[model samples]
Target chain A: MKDGLVVLDKVSYGYSPERPVLARCSFQLDANERVGLVGTNGSGKTTVLKLIVGLLKPTSGHVRIFGQPCCNERDFREVRRRVGFLFQDSDDQLFCPTVAEDVAFGPLNMGKSREEVRRIVSRTLSLLGLGGFETRITYKLSGGEKRMVALAAVLAMLPEVLLLDEPTAGLDDAAAQHVVDVLAELPQAMVLATHDPRLLGGLVNRSLRLTAGRFTPESSRDWAANPAVRSARQQTA
Target chain B: MANVIENAATYDASFVPASVWRLDGVDPRTRLIAAVSFSVLVTAVDSLPTLVAALAVVVVGAGWTGALGQQRWKRLIPVNLLVLMLLGLLPLSGGATPVLSVGPIVVAREGLVQALWIGLKANAIVLGVLVLLARLEMASIGYALGRLGVPEKLTHLLLFTVRYLEVLQREYTRLWSAMKMRGFRPRVDGHTYRSFGYLVGMLLVRSVDRADRIVAAMKCRGFCGRFHPLDHAALTVRDAWFSALVLVVLAGLAALEWA
Candidate 1:
């Protein structure tokens, strides 16, 4: 545990005690590292990312971020400020009237000046090749455009770590490729929970396999570093 | 990518205010103020000449701005229905002189005048809002309300509803199409009602899920209780001119009502 940026130690969670989503799950995201999380549809891959950001409280486990225990909402406030979470559904993340407003929401909430938020919004939108989309209505945007705008909204906060859930799902090849290209250039550490194995070629440095509420034995450091594999399962979390 | 975004504007025509109004440049606060003043003045006018004059002014303004999308006159339908009902019922129930009647139903002249005044006043207010305020985007209205000393929470509710109305509408349509594909026809029966009820329940449940996710996303970016709107651009000369023009019309209506 070499000062992992995020560490989930023996975490267990369930919507109900009778059915468990994640049990004794342990993982870590190191600085400047990009780890791809793969699992079946309900294997709790999403739960892992949520646990990292304190979006969901574990039934029993220790969740640490920036080397501090995040057991309550107040502690997670700091964690959330440094962590960007991209939702699986773009619609869930975009609640503002316009592209610029949605992008500015986070920064403005974080107490950034209006002028500074505007600058960040423009920069983030352009970074995703969506420049000049400030005033565009969010609902009117096409699917691909909406995805990029959602990404811009998250990136506008300038988080040090990103937890992206199915970042490339449902996108056409070009659109997904565009996302892959932009994400590959980012300096932040990220845990990409995705089901697409080959969509983002050479972008993820390693992979982890989650199953039945826990990581597979093969997901240990030995095989996770290997570059070749069949379809990878990223969490919808 | 530039082409993709450039193409976004092809569908962007509907959201932005059209310049045909010759008042698109006016600030929304100005338009809102004008609408308030016009509606108030029209409501106070009891004289037939003043009410008719106000209605005329509103109808001409509506013509100048052009109507919204389609079904332009559909909004006035409910008002017309109510007016017709009043004209028929009010004249029969009261008033002084019997103008016309068949059998036991006698139409009274006083009741007719009262009904006519109510109809005119209603039409004038509705038409006035359509011309002066309805053309503005809903977001503009929320912002104007905030600027007009409306409570922050109320304006937030307005803006939030506006932001997600289309999205929720699409969700509703998706559910409806799924139902249609499954041979679900909206017949006037228990089965149809139950199915519709179930659809609404599912939509509400999904809305709760979406709302949860949206809040989580917001928190992920350091949101507390406060919300910040981006720009607070000052009202321009155009807004002033528009406000002045609206005040003049309102003043003229007052003179007619009293003089």
Candidate 2:
């Protein structure tokens, strides 16, 4: 965690005090590492990603991005500009009425000129196979198209690292495969949070299982085949 | 299903092309101002002949864009029916100039004229606003309003609400289907009312949750309460010409009313 690009040390968070979702989750993401935060439903996988970008402050421990501790909102502003966050719900992220505007939101927010942002938006959308889709209404697009546009919006910012929370969650088999292919070609180091073992195979270089409040290294590539992950770190290491 | 609706939309999006008065190149700001001023003029002018002429002008001007052609009965019928009801009640109010009578009932000519004026004015204002703004991209209204010194929060609200309305509608549809699948049926009973109340309550709760997520998403992209709409709509020669045309029409209508 010390040398990682994004590090969370002893992070814990929950909506209520009675039930803490994450007790002391420790995680790290290197510059080039495509890490998968694998977990079951309601295992605080999203919380870990949120903590990294300061969307949610950790209840007890420190959250670090770019080797700087983010204790407040102001510190996270710089962190957010450099880190791209892809939410599970593409609908929530694609708030602009048109595809081009939504994609331009991030770059423009960082004070890029309209001309530069226009170029960025077109280039990013074309990269995501959404060429000539600038004027297309965000809501009118199909679910798969919406997801790609959302990815385009994130990628348009040209962030160094991506915190992708279930990028292929609602997508169909073909759409999910398309997303995986798109994500694989991206140069940004991403920490993808998902329960899908199939998604982790070619996309992620390392996998960390989030269960009960903490992260533990997972080695068995076929974890889906053997659901009973015997905490086989000793066997692999 | 979507394709069917889209086909219908495509079919209905075109109307009789009086393309000579097309204001497609006009800036939304000019359109907004013109629409507002035209609405004010319609509402203020009470002269029957003037109102009739204004309605004619409005129809011809707004009709060029073909927005007036879409869902003709669906949009106009409701408003016209409501106006008809008002007209029906207007003649019963008793007036000085009676034009017709059956037994003891008297239909006042002045009341009928007033009703016609009301209908014309209402239709003119609404149709004028619709054709002026609705022809452009719906999202541009927010940015146009923003540029016209509208508060940023309102612009953001308009943009986000317009953006998410479809999502919420889809969610509502899914919930309705779920409820129907569960054997829920509307009846004239307490159970029906309670179920509806629960449905609305659930929608509200989910909307709040979604709003929170949307805000978080916005923050992740460095949205610092400053809504910088990525629009480059400058007031061009077309806007100036359109603005001049709007002024001339309104002035002519005003002179017609006063005379």
Per-candidate DockQ values are 0.74, 0.76
What lDDT tens digits, residue by residue, belong to model 1 across residues A1-237? 466999999999998999999988898889988888887888888889888888899999899898998899999998888899998889888888788999999999888898888889988988888998998878778878888898888888899999999998989866876787778789999998886645333567777788888875333344434353222223211
lDDT of 1 by residue, B1-259 (tens): 2233223223223443466666677888888888888888877777778888888888888777775444456668878899999988888886679999889888899999888889888888988887777666677788899999999999988877766656666677788899999999889999999998898898789878888888888888788888888989798998878878888888888988786
Which residue runs does candidate 1 get wrong by more than 4 Å? A217-237, B1-17, B67-73
True contacts kept of each: 0.96, 0.92
In candidate 1, the residue pairs with backbone N, CA or C atoms under 3 Å apart (3 or more residues apart, or in different chains) clash, namely A38-A233, A39-A233, A46-A237, A194-A234, A195-A234
- The per-candidate TM-score of the B chain, in the order shown, comes to 0.86, 0.84
- CAPRI docking class of candidate 1: medium
| Candidate 1, residue A46: how far the Cα is off, in Å | 1.8
Superposed model 2: Cα runs more than 4 Å off: A223-237, B1-21, B97-110
- Looking at model 2, give its docking quality level: medium
Highest-DockQ candidate = 2
Give the lDDT of residue B172 in candidate 1.
76
